[model samples]
Target: MSIEAIGAIGAVEAVEPAALGVPAAPVAAPGFADWIAREVGQVDATLATSENDLRRLATGQVQNLHEVMIHMEEAKLSFQLLAQVRNRLLDAYQEVMRMQV
Candidate 1:
């Protein structure tokens, strides 16, 4: 028997960068910017897919209600995690900005 507490953990790992005009990651030894960009791009992709699924469901194109709900919840958790990351980063940046030289 298997139980899924939060599906977002896996979903967060499933995004690939399509809009960046560059390879997804590690093809050229990814840097910090590359890593962050890839993460954001992937989360964005997940959110986009979730949104599309919602639209399809509303239009009766989706047959599995449970699957759609799972996807939506994953997207929600992913977004919340992303938001927390952003907040922490911003806080760190502000702290750095306030530091004395």
Candidate 2:
């Protein structure tokens, strides 16, 4: 390809707001509390599903024991992870509270 053709091919096409002196759009980032709330909410949903499975098994309406066990394990793991995250956050908060500042 000719130099001019190559130059055209290499030309910038991506949006460049600063190049045209236009301000970029604002983007909202999730706060730490929001992130923690989402994690807890997900774990709560898993636990609720596990509870339903337990209820079904108690009522002799369970389809598969294996599936219930899997759900129980999944719920257990999610709860454990969420609990650990919460504990760590608490510890961090306590540490910050102890700070001189």
Candidate 3:
């Protein structure tokens, strides 16, 4: 499954202000920390699910080995993406620290 699919699985509905008889207000975007935390949580959950699938396969509980392998690959890819994001964030922080105010 793709990132969009994962996001769709956890999608939340937006509530309109008019429906609640309230005035619309500016909504603050999520901070980088919050975004990163959420991503990390998703990656963790993916890894855990993949691991469970693997265990099930090992115990002869799972009928399809291909599905287990796919889950493993998905977990691996998500981890790599998270690691790259972390590296980029660290590099940006270091660059900012080196600059003179």
Candidate 4:
């Protein structure tokens, strides 16, 4: 291809946002139940994986201490994050219930 054609291709590829002609919508925040469910699911998956690794380790299927430790840590962090989310949700519910009509 010629240099001029390459330059034109580059120019077309660098189109500005205005040229797209569509406004982005504002993002909506997730509800408390939705957030809790997502966090719970993540923690559940992590826990399941850790359990599987532990089983494998017991059966002499895999022998990597570092890998087991990493999986354990991941499960721990996920559980901690889920617990915090649950506490926040409970606090919000209590605050709403205490509101005077």
Candidate 5:
């Protein structure tokens, strides 16, 4: 399924930065921006579903606490993955800036 479909299934809402009155950063390329946006959307959807599952478990709507714990761990792993990616990007930018012209 596409990112949008997954988001819809998870009932995740998209918030535009501009709509929130935040200035948008200029993307180096449209395709790159779209790819990043899709990944972010997927992460957001997963986190939302994980949170909902925890809520359900807390309210006794769900029987298995293990499932909620698994989802929470998955979200944590995804967040770590995103953090690594960000770190790598920052390192690359720093390397480029330090290059002798």
Candidate 6:
């Protein structure tokens, strides 16, 4: 249920004091592309762990069925959340394209 990847939502770029003739400082925080890559990597890892647990269950190596089910559910939810975010971003991009400039 934790969506730490969405923590990039409020990141702002560093601005320069152009009026004072000062150059802009480099941003220290990770960018949107990095965040997306990290989030996708997390989702992939979750899914892989769930798949491994399922395989272990099939091989009769898993003792707790509940824990395996929980992992599966976690993976499912993570993927769903990622999908929703992608859909929203796509919708926004399409809307922007349709706007008359």
TM-score of each: 0.67, 0.72, 0.73, 0.64, 0.67, 0.73
Report the Cα lDDT for residue 87, model 3: 96
Q: Identify the runs in model 4 with alpha carbons over 4 angstroms from their true place.
A: 1-32
Which structure is stronger by TM-score: 1 or 6?
Answer: 6
Q: Please give the lDDT score at residue 9 for candidate 4.
A: 73
Model 1: lDDT equals: 0.85
Q: Worst 10-residue stretch by lDDT in candidate 4?
A: 9-18
* Candidate 2 runs further than 4 Å off: 1-21
- Per-residue accuracy of model 4 over 1-101 as CA lDDT, tens digit each: 68898778767666665579866565788896787787788889999999999999999898797898899999999898778877997899999999999
**Ranked by lDDT, top first:** 6, 3, 2, 5, 4, 1
- Cα error of candidate 6 at position 72, Å: 0.0
> Candidate 5 lDDT, tens digit per residue, 1-101?
68888778668578899999999998766686688788888888889999999889889999888899999999988888878988998999999999999
Q: Candidate 6: which pairs clash?
A: none
Overall local distance difference test of candidate 6: 0.94
Q: Could you give candidate 1's per-residue lDDT for residues 14-100 as a string of tens digits? A: 455766566656556668788888888888988998999999999999999898899889888988988998899999999999999
State the local distance difference test value for candidate 5. Answer: 0.87
The runs of at least 3 residues in candidate 5 whose Cα sits more than 4 Å from the true structure, single-residue gaps closed, are 1-30
lDDT of 3 by residue, 1-101 (tens): 68888889667688788888997787899998898899999999999999999999989999999999999999999999999988998999999999998
Better of 3 and 5 by TM-score: 3
lDDT values for all models: 0.85, 0.92, 0.93, 0.86, 0.87, 0.94
The alpha-carbon lDDT assigned to residue 7 of candidate 1 equals 60
Kindly list the per-residue Cα lDDT of model 6 for residues 1-101, writing each as its tens digit. Answer: 45765666557556559756887786789889999999999999999999999999999999999999999999999999999999999999999999998
Between which residue pairs do clashes occur in model 1? none
C-alpha lDDT of candidate 4 relative to the true structure: 0.86
